[model samples]
Target: MAIFDDEPRKKARPHEIGQDLSLLSVDELS
Candidate 1:
């Protein structure tokens, strides 16, 4: 993993969860 991201992406789960939750407030359009 890249510490914040990942290669295969599985490792990015933590990053994704954090960002996704953070973005949720502004992601109402999506």
Candidate 2:
């Protein structure tokens, strides 16, 4: 219950994790 309450209550869709990383260059990360 706590996990669901804290989280968005939805499973992560495919290809969702790295989308933001793709937008960033190496310099921005460092």
Candidate 3:
């Protein structure tokens, strides 16, 4: 959740879908 919250502050455009993508990427990395 922290990743999703922090991502929007930096990306700030496609938060709708981008948050999911970011979560996936973090999951894969983890």
Best by lDDT: 3
Candidate 2 residue-wise lDDT, 1-30, digit = tens:
879643542333223345555534442343
Prediction 1 global C-alpha lDDT: 0.52
Task: Identify the leading candidate in terms of TM-score.
Answer: 3
TM match of model 3 to true structure: 0.36
lDDT of 1 at 10: 54
Tens-digit lDDT track of model 3 for 1-30: 999867764565455346687765665455
Ranked by TM-score, the better of candidates 1 and 2 is 1
- Candidate 2: list runs displaced more than 4 Å: 9-30
Regions more than 4 Å wrong, model 1 = 1-7, 21-30
Worst 10 residues of 3 by lDDT: 8-17
lDDT of each prediction vs. the true structure?
Answer: 0.52, 0.41, 0.61
TM-score, prediction 1:
0.31
lDDT of 1 by residue, 1-30 (tens): 365343435544455568886654444333
- Backbone clashes counted, model 1: 0
**Model 3 residue 27 CA deviation in Å:** 0.2
